[model samples]
Target: MTDHGPQPVERQLPTEESRALISLVRDLTQREIAPTAAEEEDAGHFPREVFGLLSASGLLALPYAEEFGGGDQPYEVYLQVLEELAAARLTVGLGVSVHTLACHALAGYGTKEQRRTHLPAMLGGGLLGAYCLSEPAAGSDAAALRTRATRVGDTWTIEGTKAWTTHGGIADFYTVLARTGGEGPHGITAFLVPGDAPGLTAAPPERKMGMKGSPTAQLHFDGVEVADARRLGDEGQGFAIALSALDSGRLGIAACAVGVAQAALDQALSFTQERRQFGHPVADFQGLRFMLADMATQIEAGRALYLAAARLRDTGRPFAKQAAMAKLFCSDAAMRVTTDAVQLMGGYGYTADFPAERYMREAKALQIVEGTNQIQRMVVARHLAGPGGAP
Candidate 1:
């Protein structure tokens, strides 16, 4: 009777089935997503067809139960798929990640009836979801959210604004966290609010420096009514549910960061080999080669971090801290790698012709979202000082 921490019980590294799935997904992403990604991103249009492809491919629901028409794969495998998608088009990868985050509330804490009600559409092609945790004043301090969900005659009336909702206006539903009691984290409660629920209005999309294809907007809940049945978990479990979902969501961001870093590295490698300077290829320079080596090392280390965290999650271990570490380390590495990648390309990297500039923009957003890197450091530090944790 040996104890294995969050490693998946049935995990195997890149099995034949897994490899085949990866190959198919990679081909589809590269062919279908990469070609038009720049244009779509530039135009700020949602890649709606890409979502359809992902849903049809059984990828949008990879981390869910097989009973719900999901892939039911381990987080380890699912993250690799996320990395592949991100390497091709980060916007699509991010949308998938956000959708996964929204599903976490229903999947982890919802009643059986709630699961049956919401899981299918979420896992299906026709619907997308948004997570409502951050408020105008509460980004990292999610517990400080001011949104109120008051119980009145068996119905909950929600009133407050949720800021920075990915897929805000476009989502079919939102997993909302509101203050059901007093102040602090304990007063919070989670609910499922339909997009068309009366008094729920989404503001116009914010103009972001990057990840423009995946819109971010504020959700205004002005006396929006929801049935008591829409509650997720216990009355005060919203904060808990949000944290748990973020632990999983952090890993998704880590995978996407790794994908962005890998894309930058691959582009840098190709450009350095072909771009001639000083009577030879730029890659021939020992100084440039060393930088490339560093980039490769960072990418591999970041991948390893996320894989370890994913393994922890798959085996049902306490992975919140590790997931934070992975997200923090990978996003920072991505920022560094992509910046260096842009430098390595000399001039062309800065241009929109290559994907390097887009990678740079996309990398910065990951560092800020899913809990900022500063917040991630705080989580890791807490874990280090606690009983049986990292130091």
Candidate 2:
């Protein structure tokens, strides 16, 4: 594996502490992640130890409150750390994002007692988590999910399957949404399910195109019981909780997309400069130079867009529209930039010997996850217009 150390990204950190944090992350990524990323990914290995290290180092808890053993960093700082991690390895970066998403319900909506009991262990106790929302039949239409949870004397029994769950089988805990009433979003409720619960099992991981190291699988819940105390919010509020979590999760996807794009651009730059043509390095040619310029511009713009949205979130502002825009724009930008990176490298880019192909494959997944790019457009449109799209 070619250890192309951390590429220089001129970050606008708010504090010296954050700058030092980034420097620390870069050092960590260079030392631990980047070196074995390709080899482990190729072998379809999930780096659970790396996640353990992150939890031990407090990287896993950056955006949450310090009262619960979290890092107490703002979204702005937390997301930049995500960007740095993603630049090293998407499996690690997006895994942290999904873990954060899994913790969202309890952090944002759980009662004080719930936080006191569960938040600290979740945030920093070396536990991995998964978010369960999408099902096999209900991907885009999440409200139509068929997962049913029946209440009986202070206990809820969940029986259904959740699909496309990242870290599905390996997660220590799962944040699950199940229908408790009639139908649609209003009938749903959220629960924190222990991974070791009886009757809860996971299917084998999906054979994916990229991020092969990250396990995506279907989770089965057959009579999995939970205490009423584990309920996240009021009855029939799970859909709202899920949507709220998605808003922040989309920003995470945007940051990861930009990170992948930056990695591709770095590969293109390195390759073009080293591989020479007739008289000079291919990077010196006008056409390839122009391509590199465009790639860099797109990456910078995507970074700025995500950071802008992160700032809004950090400041307690209505940033849903901007979050959708950032997810859509940054993911689309990642697709284009990765494709261009491959093109600039010509035949070499298409081969497995280089990381460009892997980056391109990984970029494709970002457009589809956390709501597809088309769904993002609909979200942005709904924010701009009314529910019926009337401006």
Candidate 3:
């Protein structure tokens, strides 16, 4: 259940270093990650040790600046690294993506002093992080969030409940968005809160359908006090900051979706080639063969689409539209590909002994992470033809 051989497609890397990095990541996946993926996921264990290993290997800081102890790799290389990790285990892949999202505020919007002070340890240190944006009432309608942060002279008190935080209970830091002024997007502010702040606490991890190895819970900031210096950006700019991070985070999710889809396709092809039907192998059947073709095609197309968006981001161009399209297409593709893989595997796919069932279950979360498929469509629509067709 833990094994996934080489992918059918060949990757194009910009440098030999990137190629070497991918090779190292694949080796680590097979030895350290894949061997325990099924057992740990089944037992609902989070592999903090594996994350520590990644941090030590410079895997955790691939996309940040080298000055801050990051690898300074392009988004293209960073995302492919994500695909390889997700291919091994979705829990690890998505966890790394969320940690990257958590750092976006500090890396992009923090004062230079803040960056110099905090980013090196976060980028290279063995500490994990989480992002706090959604609330009980504000999953998609983020501007409707009710979490409040009030000024008290040199300090600020944050009081809110952040729902669906990926590393809620175990994170060492949280990049939180809270209301600082009024009732809309413009009033929001971003803050960097330490995990052990006086009033910050996390609820028990949610009982999820898949990726149970990763913790997702509601974080309660019961009047957590932070020094004014901990503020991430200007007082009224958090929503913008959050949206910016999501643009990049959506690409991470897309890469992960492709990884899951690719793994499913590889398994289905292996199964069909080995299982015999009548006098010939199951792969000889045109009907099942066409299904495999479609699955592989979607996986390749999703990969291409995400890489295209990542390239745009790497070149410092506007990629929100492309990012949304990639997320919408790739996540949908993962769900479809995994579902087909399960169907093609027949009874074996439905059983726990095979990984097709687990892949299918994990694929469902990709469609809903970062942004729901419906939201992605809305974003693309807004890009192509302004809101309400006013453009």
Span of 10 residues, lowest total lDDT, candidate 2:
1-10
Runs in model 2 lying further than 4 Å from the true structure: 1-6, 389-391
Cα TM-score of candidate 3: 0.98
Q: Compute each candidate's TM-score over C-alphas.
A: 0.94, 0.98, 0.98
lDDT tens digits, residue span 1-391, model 1: 1111111112245578887778788778767887788888999989987887788778889889987667888899999888888888899888999988998999889988888877887897567888999989999888889999999988999999999999999888899999999989999999999989999999999999999899999999999999999999999999999999999999999999998898888888878888898889999999999999999899889999999999899998889999999999999999999999999987888998888888999999999999999989989888887544432
Q: Is candidate 1 or candidate 2 better by lDDT?
A: 2
- lDDT for each candidate structure: 0.88, 0.94, 0.92
Backbone clashes for every candidate come to: 2, 0, 0
Give the alpha carbon lDDT tens digit for every residue of 1-391 in model 3: 4345436357889999999999899989888987788789999999999999999998889999998889999999999999999988999999999999999999999998999999988888898999999998999888889999999998999998999999998999999999999988999999999999998898999999999899999999998999999999999999999999999999999999998898899989988888897988898999999999999899889999999999999999999999999999999999999999999989999987878888999999999989899999999999887897422
Q: After superposition on all CA atoms, what RMSD does each candidate show versus the true structure?
A: 6.4, 1.4, 1.5
Global CA lDDT computed for model 3: 0.92
Give residue 300's lDDT in candidate 1 (0 to 100): 86
